[model samples]
Target: MERLSLNQITTDNWNMREAVEGCARASIPWIALWRHKVQQAGLAESKRYVRDAGLRVSSLCRGGMFPAATKSERQARIDDNRRAVEEAAELGTDVLVLVCGPAPDRNIDDARKMVEEGIEQLVPYAVSCGVRLGIEPLHPMYAAERSVINTLSQASDIAERYAANQVGVVVDVFHVWWDPDLYRQIARANGRILGFHVSDWIVPTPDLLMGRGMMGDGVIDIRRIRKAVDSAGYTGPIEVEIFNRSIWDAPGDEVLALMKERYTQHV
Candidate 1:
């Protein structure tokens, strides 16, 4: 579990301070941050606090909801993403995970186009800011409300259009395990893979978005995928990003412990 990283959302109830301290006490050297939690602790101070706690920021939580009804609203979201880029700079994390939200005004094709175009605009700026944008392909369950980019192939399609240092595909197991071409696509990513997230999806998920299982608690072969990622030349952090409500409701310290144990034994 040395490469294990605890994503803040796994214990969403804890404030940024507790999350940092929890990782420190558990000896977990890395963590992934959510922007909202960072704002609650204040951006500059968040950076100082994480550094003081001796933790590395694996990736910043989010920065994409590109489809909007009007041009102004789209521009507003783009502006917000720019701020996300700046926040990532302050937090000392190069990768910013993006959940390209579904669009209300158009079909999947158009919504995806918006995502591609949106990231294209941010790529140059992200390069300048020294941040890499990670395009996360959420499960197809999120096709209508959460994200239009639902496959690693689609994300790779976009990432192939930009430099890997500026834009890369995020391999979150829960989202891509069902793809028949997952391993092939992982190989195709080669050096373009950014952050790798580990989590299991229950056989019959109670909640599409929030009901994620702990490692080894579900059917996914976590280590197999990790090996595929490793084989693809991605030596970065393998973050555990579980969004289950019960996990979040539990004590943060205990959650961290179990996450580490599961990562050690299962991942």
Candidate 2:
């Protein structure tokens, strides 16, 4: 439980201040924030709340959606990611998790190229802000609407293009646990892993985006993956990032208490 960090989305009912205070009350020590909540609370005010609560921000939830039909649209995404980088810096977190978006059209290959180019464009600004872009590949099922990059190997391919400090991969067990090449890719990621997220994959998934289960509630072998990440030399926070509606509907305190229990027993 020492390295546990609650990704705020797990307790979706809590606002920014409440989440920060919740973390403090639970003695969680670290938080992973989402951009919308931060914006709703006012970035400066949110930063102040976390700082005052003596909590550390693990990584900003997201900063990438680089695929668009037009060059202008894509550039707008780049600009928004720049703002995300600034937000991450001000919030005292150095990792900006990137959920590389789906293809704008059917040309997934072109969309992927755009993803790489977008990272290429954003790397300099991220580096300037003392932030690292952590590309989080979504599950292959989300290829149509969520993220085109669908594996740790793909994320690593992109991260290797830039300096390890400027770009890295985020491993979320819910997304990568089924990969046959998971262990090998994790070994290859070594020093370039920026974040690690934990969530079980329900066997009969009810939703593609929000079906994630709390640890030990589903079929994932989370501890094995956690061991692999540790072996890869990433001694960082293990963020519990469940997106299940049922989990979100539960009381925040109950969720936190259970999260701690699961972290001890499962992760």
Index of the highest-lDDT prediction: 2
State the lDDT of candidate 2 residue by residue for 110-208, as single tens digits: 999999999999999989989999999889999999899999999999999889999999999999998999999999999999999998988898898
Per-residue lDDT, model 1, residue 176, is 96
TM-score of each: 0.98, 0.99
Give the Cα RMSD of candidate 2.
0.7
- Scanning candidate 1 in windows of ten residues, the lowest lDDT window is 103-112
Tens digits of lDDT, candidate 1, 28-101: 98999999999999998888889999999999989999988778888898999999999998898999999988
Clashing pairs in 1: none
Computed on alpha carbons, the lDDT of every model, listed in order, comes to 0.91, 0.94
